[model samples]
Target: MSTNALPPVVDTDTWQKELAALRIREKAATRELDAIAAQRRRLPMVQMPDYVLEGEHGPVRLAEIFGDHPQLIVYHHMWNDGAEWQCGGCTGFTSQFTRLEGLASFDARFVIVTHGPIGEALAYKRKVGNTMTWYSTANSSFGSDVGAPRDGGFAVNVFLRDGDTVYRTWHTDGRGTEQLSYLFGLIDILPYGRQEVWQDSPAGWPQGPTYSRWLDSDAIAAAYGEPN
Candidate 1:
């Protein structure tokens, strides 16, 4: 390891003083995030069409996806037709949310909506060992309507259901979805951070091409010796 790459070593008193200073900034940032979340809560929503999508069972309506819950969170997974594996970033991100029972208490449900065929999407989900409920928009404009068109990109969309009506409350893609990923949050707190070239880091810090370290479903499954 290069000495230049490491953070400078300081005495206990100096370290404590610096850490205390950083804590103030951290607390301020936390407060700022809380304020932004308050703004997000107040944002208006747009009504959505009654698009039908393919689920594990059969054809299911968009409103039905809420499944007795008033709020729905969908991870718009990117898909490439006929590909054995799916998007690494999407797969990795979606995989982290294996358990979402806690959301039930909040009256919110989380699921994955992809442009891939239902069978292929489910197969990929299994290949990656993701337990999240997945639905396919291959035969509908739901994917395109929600900003995850076929061959396009991934997104995070939030919807609210009132009786039989559904409305889109929020949508975010690219780096905007970072806040939902604990993996990114954890990596960001590390000394090296993501080690991605685009990040602002001190001189001589290790950095590589963006997303070069991301692993697709197949790669992740193989690494863990999970059946694919």
Candidate 2:
């Protein structure tokens, strides 16, 4: 019944080495991502449909968002109607997405299409404080046409267009775990953790199994400035 003795703490030299290793691994990961991008780039091109959809301006064609690029990546966000039940995990994935302003270099336009109305979706965007371009498929067939689930979930759909041809290149539809690649989980290795922040919160605070606590009507309003 004796306790183990402790050795003198290292002065972060080991930690520094570990950090270097992590950086190396990150580079390797980046190379892998480049290979995957090559695969995606090799996908055959098609003419995107001339279908017009509502945008912040009004009716906008799918080609309008593409600019000079022929590829588009759309994240179908499920911003629920009210605060009763929202996908906490999606909030986290989107939180990371909001910071990517230079995504155009990927030769694709990354936009978010929501199931909520334009007004409501804008409110959610404001609340979440995500700068990613957003559009509401609330009044359009774009959601179901592209197989966006009626309920709510995250889908990363890649489309390629040539002339007027639009073809679906790739799509990933995993609700929770799949987001690790897109969310903070991809870059997080801290001893603290990835998404347990909302869980390990102090008492008298809202706690949940997902990252939804950071969202709510009030939070949305605060971020977007009183949904008008």
Candidate 3:
């Protein structure tokens, strides 16, 4: 079991050079992200009329969730309204919800909205042990109107609802998945490698490309074996 038998790293200094190059790329990426966020901040605001959505406790209105705040940022995670596994990327993002309290202090409410029934969404949250607020679009047009219908997949939609008038501020549908991952500092670990991607994984390793929908219970179990 000698660990030194592996081939010697040719030109060890190359790693330092690679590290420098990566740093430069990282800085450029950060600048680009900042520009995008500036654009996001400039999006138009809207007043959302009070509307009810199903929650774990019972029925609650959008206003109740926001409390006195006028801004609500809903993460339309692609749960497929009861799909076997929650999206993998979403699971990663939701796992970091505890750090979002700063946004809350800024009069912002971050909630995960899905077409999944309230009960179903709660069950998934329980399975993942996520503390973030989970809401169901079961009794509301919020999901569809925000471009996150059951089949619509994952998206991040910012809304400003004064009373009953809901104005769509900004919405991201595609690689917006990148924000949640990057926000949670999970993107930085990519270069370190994902355990699931190990080519020589032990017997029962989750062998597949990681997707956002694997946040669900069944998929998590199937891909990565038993949950911790």
Candidate 4:
């Protein structure tokens, strides 16, 4: 298949009718998502112990990361000490969430966590140019406790606070973590989509190996510095 085929052309009236049909399905999807969210809110939560982690501000407790907020979300970024570069996927995730101040109004906060020494984690932060709240789970069981064990796997963990106890509310990983990046949702509606090989596109639409271009573009090594 060529890489330049276009979508089928149709009469204006036919296009409008087709669009209207899609709109109906989209609305149904929105309603279903709302229903799922309502269920998510009602799901049971588990009690979490106070885990210490190091951040830009030095050592802090998991509860302190939530501060006075009732809800917290942590992105378990993949950043082992010996890795040459930070995870490009995690880099993309952090890039989308740097300006999450709006969540604070709802008593929610977001942070990124990694299993590494603080120095290595800070270097990765500089490499990716992410200024969001990032921390290290080194010398702590935070990784295993949250199911983002140091051996492998990344996760987005949700937690809630009641009195002085923190509770695990929810978590997701892999494609589920893609929702963290607004770009993923934005590009999903584009004509050619994400341009990755896995997408369903017209015979001639562009496709390529995933993350090759990602690394070529954003994989530069950089001098280490604390993000203010």
Report every candidate's CA lDDT.
0.90, 0.65, 0.69, 0.80
lDDT measured at residue 167 in model 4 versus the true structure, 0 to 100? 95
After superposition, which runs of candidate 1 have C-alpha atoms over 4 Å from their true positions? 1-4, 223-228
Candidate ranking under TM-score, highest first, comes to: 1, 4, 3, 2
lDDT of 1 by residue, 141-207 (tens): 9989888878789999999999999999999999999999899889988989989999999998999
- TM-score to true structure, per model: 0.95, 0.65, 0.69, 0.90
lDDT of 3 by residue, 121-216 (tens): 887777766777898987888787768877767788776766655566877777665665644355335432343453454444345565432354
Backbone clash pairs for candidate 2 read 46-165, 47-164, 47-165, 47-166, 48-164, 48-165, 48-166, 88-212, 126-224, 127-220
Against the true structure, candidate 4 reaches a TM-score of: 0.90
- lDDT per residue, candidate 2, 187-206, as tens digits? 24533333344445333333
The model with the greatest TM-score is 1
Model 3 vs. true fold: TM: 0.69
The candidate 3 region of ten consecutive residues with least summed lDDT is 187-196
Candidate 3 residue 80 C-alpha distance from true site, Å:
4.6
Stretches > 4 Å off in candidate 2: 1-32, 45-48, 82-86, 98-101, 175-187, 195-228
